[model samples]
Target: MAEADPMKGVVARLDELVAIRPRAGGGFAPGGKVRTHQLGGHRSGFRGRGMEFDEVRAYQPGDDIRTIDWRVTARTGRAHTKLFQEERERPVLVLADARAAMRFGTRGCFKSVLAAQAAAILSWVGIAGGDRVGGVVIGPAGVATFRPERSRRRILSFVKSIADATADAPRAGEPPLAAAIAHIRALARPGSLIFLVSDFFDLDDHAVREVERLALQSHVTNLFVFDPLEAALPGAGSFPVTDGRIVARLDVDRPAARAVYAQRFQARRDAVERMSRERGMTFLPLDTGQNPVDILHPERLGAKPSAAARSAR
Candidate 1:
């Protein structure tokens, strides 16, 4: 028998994703060292006085010197330390867009496939960390959502839904990724880790505002799934493309046509980046050609601890 091609099947297979586990747990280190992309450490729940500086108490045997309250120590004639604790257990929610734009890819898989693959990797990671897994798949057909759950059955169901939603092409009479982000706004809970996977072809002000609002309470990471061909033309040549309605010939050899075409994608990417930066959200660039698992794992990120927060983000 022959081994299966990673890209030939369901963006990503459940068995394949589950097979790749993190060396360490998906949580952060003992102290707090998160990557630049994350807000650092979980704060969903707390044990001691966190950041409010509630009060100072006599230093215990294992008290951290950095937290020593100088004024309180001197006045009390005894070393005292400030105390703060933060505890958290967050859910991972993946929002995938299978819109018409994501339906086209000039690589091993479609942008929708890439989106599903990325979502599956994150879902398995969340399961590894003991977090609930859930997702929303929005495509030409409409929006499909799954509530976060820690059960394997729930995670598998969500992945299947994503693949099914993206399996078909855009119909001529479909609406524009209807109520995609709006659905997320309604489903995502505070302190949850939200992954938005999409080509963002129709990101209007309304969509932007919904994401912005969701990020205010939940951690939102924008996973822009695009194809390299969308970023640049294949040298100087003529290519044929379609949006399910009209099949058009693109003559990249024409003057400035390639530049204009590439700029359109660049501009949208730029806007998403600017928004992400301003909000301290994580932005991961994934193309249909790359292996989504290697690029998205919590430990494999450019920085390990930093990558740790990507799942949390």
Candidate 2:
């Protein structure tokens, strides 16, 4: 008999990551006001295509004479001009974190695995929507970057890098969260859609500033990946914990200890969520116990995993 793979959920596989491409269709496309001039499906904040009618208002000096609404102008005995919304393609960049801290998980899969799968889905969705796909994978081995390109080959290479990064062992001199974010910002062009997928164990003020810089020109979405155990200690008990080298026991039975543990995690999560909202970035929690596909595409995959479940300490 063959033995089961011990690192099943801890390490991601290229095949599994590639398989998520098909499921990336439908409700996976992000809706937003992009800042690009390229023609595409998503609507841009500026008007250009004039395909969809916005409204007819009083004609201004700079208004296009061809857009003058004759009917409305005749009715009110005044000139009126029509406005329309322009649609354009947005570049999608997934900043996937496969850091050492993301290697641990209590349910579903490791944070690294969840981040990788979600990254793959986002990349594919961007390709399907006619947007260029690119990203940066932050792992123990360091940062790997990919330039935005509207090609399946580029997405495959990106997914493969994610899988490789997740399976790599901890190496010295890995880039910090702030540095990684800065790199991602540099890679992303103005008006690109960026996905920051990580457990976010190192989102300090410096990292926050870097993200804010990125958000100034791009639409940023922070995907907070966490495990059930990280959110709260298990019910009253002494749980055994280890990191493959060091072993310890958690006394969750103690009320004070449990309270402190839960409070610390909640505080961190809250701070991240609050910062994202304040900066007008989308914040979505990705629990390891749930499917990334379902969370990313709730309308197609059904109701998302409950937040209440994670709250029950």
Candidate 3:
């Protein structure tokens, strides 16, 4: 088989993504560290905290003091405790960005492909954890939304939607990132876990507010995906860049230009991080050069896997 062109990594194939299912398991965790390229760790406090009242029974040893049922104890004339069970099917939403800006990369694969791959891996992990998986893919054509479902079939369908979104052509007058965030705010239920994978090029004031609102109801993890070139210029020289429609010359040779470019990128990152920090959400930076599977793995993220993690893999 011929190797695919790295320059033309425009779309993500369904079969290719499906093959990643097996590798998606083992040590992966949403709050895992990406210990490479100076990309630090992320923290997540969100869990299946949604508990339902099971019953009230006589208090026994090891019963939580917080769960003590005072009314039941008073009526029964004995110490009682309320038992609760965690919700089994917590909804997990993977929001992937497949806009035109994501179609460019200098290593591994395009940002769009990386976003889809990450989203697919997260979806598989969610399903494996006995949670419902769904997603929203913001493509050049528009947005595609899938409701959360616990079935593998539903996850596969959602994966296909993400793959398909990458192949769509850029359309004018399409909905912005804020619109998609707004859509997710409406679609997501309280306590839902949302993984937002994007380069965040379109994240503006409106999108920031929208994300803030979304974070209030759901646990949002911002996976900021970017290519190495976007963060810094390769050495110092003139380079040609294009935005699908127009081509322009980028003079990285000028120190002022390089400084400005780096500052802009840092500003964008700082803004996203600020939003995440304010909302108590997780903010992770993903380089296109890094493997999505390794990045998500709890114990193997850019590090030597432990014996237990190796056995699981």
Assess the local accuracy of residue 218 in candidate 1 as a C-alpha lDDT between 0 and 100.
63
1 or 3: which has the higher lDDT?
3
TM-score of every candidate relative to the true structure? 0.72, 0.78, 0.74
Pick by TM-score: which candidate is best? 2
Error of 3 at 18 (Å): 0.7
Where is model 1 more than 4 Å wrong at Cα?
A: 1-42, 45-86, 172-178, 240-248, 297-313
Question: Runs in model 2 with CA error above 4 Å?
Answer: 1-3, 24-39, 45-87, 298-313
lDDT of 2 by residue, 3-106 (tens): 98887888999998888765423422333322123234656433322589877778865456898999999999999888776555667888999999898888
Better of 1 and 2 by TM-score: 2
How would you encode candidate 1's per-residue C-alpha lDDT over 79-151 as one tens digit per residue?
9988554455566788878767777778777787778777776776676556777878887677887888989
* Full candidate order by TM-score, most accurate first: 2, 3, 1
Clashing pairs in model 3? none
